[model samples]
Target: MTKQGAGQAGVGQRWTAPQRWTLAAAVLGSGMAFIDGTVVNVALSALQRDFGADVGSAQWVINGYTLMLAALILTGGALGDLYGRRRVFGLGVLIFAAASGLCGLAPTLGTLIAARVLQGIGGALLIPGSLAMIDAVFGDALRGRAVGLWSAATSVVTVLGPVLGGVLIDLGSWRWVFLINLPLALLVLWCLRGVPETRAAGEGARRPDLPGAVLATAGLGALTYGLIQAGERGLGGSSLLIAGLGVAGLAAFVLWEARAPHPMLPLGLFRSAGFAGTNALTFLLYGALGAALFFLPLNLIGVQGYSGTAAGTALLPMSLLLAGLSGVFGSLADRTGPRPLLTVGPILAGVGLAWLGFLGVGRPYLTGVLPGVLVLGLGMAITVAPLTSAVLGSVSADYAGTASGVNNAVSRAAGLLAVALFTLLMLGSFRGSLSAQLAGTSLPLTARAQMLGQSGRLAQVPVPDGLSDAQAAEGRQAVRLAFADGFRQVCLWCGMLAALGGLVGFLSLRGAGRGRQGGGAGENLHEPRGEEIRAGQAAPGRR
Candidate 1:
């Protein structure tokens, strides 16, 4: 293959065929990962039903992939820099396709989760390289525009993911969500030919921090397991022990990063208060956003009696609002700094979530759901661009890429933890509500016991057979109300977390400036990939 180094292309003023192909390759490759992140959420209800999985098991389907991706994405970026971006990207697509196929075919819940973990590993590699390739292929003058186009295209794909996944599940089966990725992966692989093989200059001596990556994966996995178990079974000694060990492992990772020669996360970045503060804010706000998105589909389909397609369509307005408003906020953040926007955005999002917590059964979508979704979307749109700018602006120009990548990782980590932790609240609320709702019914003591015991399954708890029609109808209503209450608890928690994120931004981002652009240290700071932000993920920040 004829390789091209960064800044070697002469077509700075116009889009050449190679540039067009490179952009196409990056968009398709990264878009595959983005689609999986969202589409799976829409399919969760069906997946759980098919496998007869509990809430914790269903959570694993999401956490398994997220755990690998969030933990190793930085290392994935490092691998590309050390090797060749195009090679690693191609390999990632292959791995993702293979994993997706396995996911579609897996017969057991455990097997499906295992396949998802592999998919996450593949995602870590391809996600970062998508933007890195554009940075390498396009000249300074065209890189921003190329990134803009890439972001716009990917955002549209992400916005449509839920709707498409809904249609697939409605028309066929949940397996189609994973199977669909196979064809997209094949397309990306074919497009890779147009993307030139590129690596950093004088990069042969550098190595990825494998030890740090391993520790991170272990620590997060343990913590997540402990949290999910605690949610289902309570804070038992075993769960507490596991959680303690997880904390210890994370402490060790920090210690290792502080001294390692080639650290995966440089500790020096935190020396800037803006960097620390903005990241804290990112963690809280994005965590809330992620949790809400994860559970809303379940609430719609399971509790509110929405069809998969209708439930998926329910979320479209919020995503569209996010996609539409990001640019306006990005430009605004440039002129006025990010502090005000960041603070207000999260608070508004918080309000939206709190409002949603009040939603009950039998309400129409337009009156009941759309209002909260709109507020949440507007707040996220306000926050996304400034959050990226805030992270980039907090560090010195030399650390721009690292800062952004760290923020991205933090947002993902936030989501990972939020889901597990809030599951505790949701389960607790569901059990209590189910008990109260069932107390008023004429069901037998045995039926009541069975329903209470299966509360962890939330709305999927099957009503016992051989009951009178009225009794069965009462059982169904009780299940719906109980599930709704649990969802309400989660939304309220998300609202508080988002509000806290705003407070962090206000206190921590007092004088943070906008990210600088052009030559020298700013060379690698391209526009943060909009698709990633709109998809509720952060852009990969690496040089």
Candidate 2:
């Protein structure tokens, strides 16, 4: 077949049986990855209780997957272009399901974290190929519509994930959350038989940037460890030593990417002011979002006296707005350009967070948090679609796949780092508040030491062993007050992050005209389909 014919062959054709099956498989696989991303957050308190875990370990459970996903996802995209997209996508599913099974069976905190790391690795591979597989099978005319359907379908899973996880926790146990993936994985594999195998035309024996992947992972892992440790051991602890090494590793990775022939990430894209600023804004905003999502459940279930399901459903307003309004906002950005939405969205988000920070202890959800949730939801809805447009617009059409991968990776990294760093803020504030609150009370020394040891529990610290019934009641009140104070401070810090994100976009992305903008490929949060990734596949291969 001629090149032009190959390009046009599937365009406007009836969706063949295989094509339908292929799209279904890819959508389900990506949904699995997406659902896992949000579902795990709601299950965190349950994990802590089951594992008898400390705060740092709990953070690691989340970060382990995120760190691998952020660091290695680009490699996954590159691999799809080189190896067959269908083959790699299937491998990723197998790995992810197996990892999920391992997670269900994990007997200890260490084991659970290890399983999650493996799961992250699988996600990195499958998430990129999930879209890329559809790109390979569909013709150019149909690819965009196919991807839109895929995105919409996946977004529904994001909304359902937390609620489903909550039901699993309440109905059975947290282990079921991991175990549930097995059937989904099986269905994906069954659908795979209809998928066409395709790879980008490339040079003979092209190699992946394995070293770059290693360096990035090492750096992020080390730095995250240090941040979590900093909360426990202070800056003087040995965790700082590891963190310093992480800094060095990252610095070295940057230098390597600049020179490598098969660079996993092309650094030159940062030269575009809009590109750099969009990404910077992504980092800041996602960091704040991650902190809020990670901790809100802890506050609701553990401190605010909500049920697991209640805590899970609390963010319905935000998630639903994001799903329902994203396309509308995307069209608006298309008409108005990204500057206004980008600038206004973060500010709204910041204001909402500040309102949440001021919530008094044990207030009702409807009055205390719902309005702030709505405002934050509106902010995210307005920003996300425009943000995607800005990122794609910032780069040349040629780099859409690479740019999208990097942006997605950055958002995940932001969340990973936020959870680590914010955990520190929570600890510092909690300890200080506890110290002051207990100073005037006659709590026994053992009681104080016990509270200190449970620092990782945040608002959920268990009752101390030796207190009298009357003293226990008093101690409970003191712990709750201290935790509440700390939570307020954490919320305030999130507000600062969102505000700073807004500032970054305002200064860097705004151009000469009001709400006017140039254009590029329309890259959304999901991996771009078609030639954006395929375009680069022809290189590194001998004719």
Scored by TM-score, the top model is 1
Candidate 1 lDDT tens digits, 152-252: 88888887877888999999998999999988888888788777888977743268899999999999999989988898778988888898888898999
Per residue, candidate 2 scores C-alpha lDDT tens digits across 1-543 of: 774565476464688777798789988998887777777777888999887787778877788888888899889877877888888899999999999999999999899999999998998899888877787777665677788788777777767777888999999998998999999999999999988888877562256799999999998888889889898889765988988988898999999999999788789989888889988988888788778667777777777777777877887787787777877987988888888888988888887777777666788888988988888878877887788778777776667767777887788778788888888988899888877777656788788778767867776677787678887877776777787787788888888898889899889876723232344443333474211101100000000
TM-score of 1: 0.95
Lowest summed lDDT window (length 10), candidate 1 = 534-543
Backbone-clash count (model 1): 0
Q: Relative to the true structure, how large is the alpha-carbon lDDT of every model?
A: 0.83, 0.78
Backbone clash pairs in model 2 (N, Cα, C under 3 Å; residues 3+ apart or in different chains), count: 6
Model 2, CA-based lDDT: 0.78
Runs of candidate 1 with Cα error greater than 4 angstroms are 1-12, 203-205, 515-530, 533-543
Error of 1 at 472 (Å): 0.7
Q: TM-score of model 2 relative to the true fold?
A: 0.92
Candidate 2 residue 419 C-alpha distance from true site, Å: 1.2
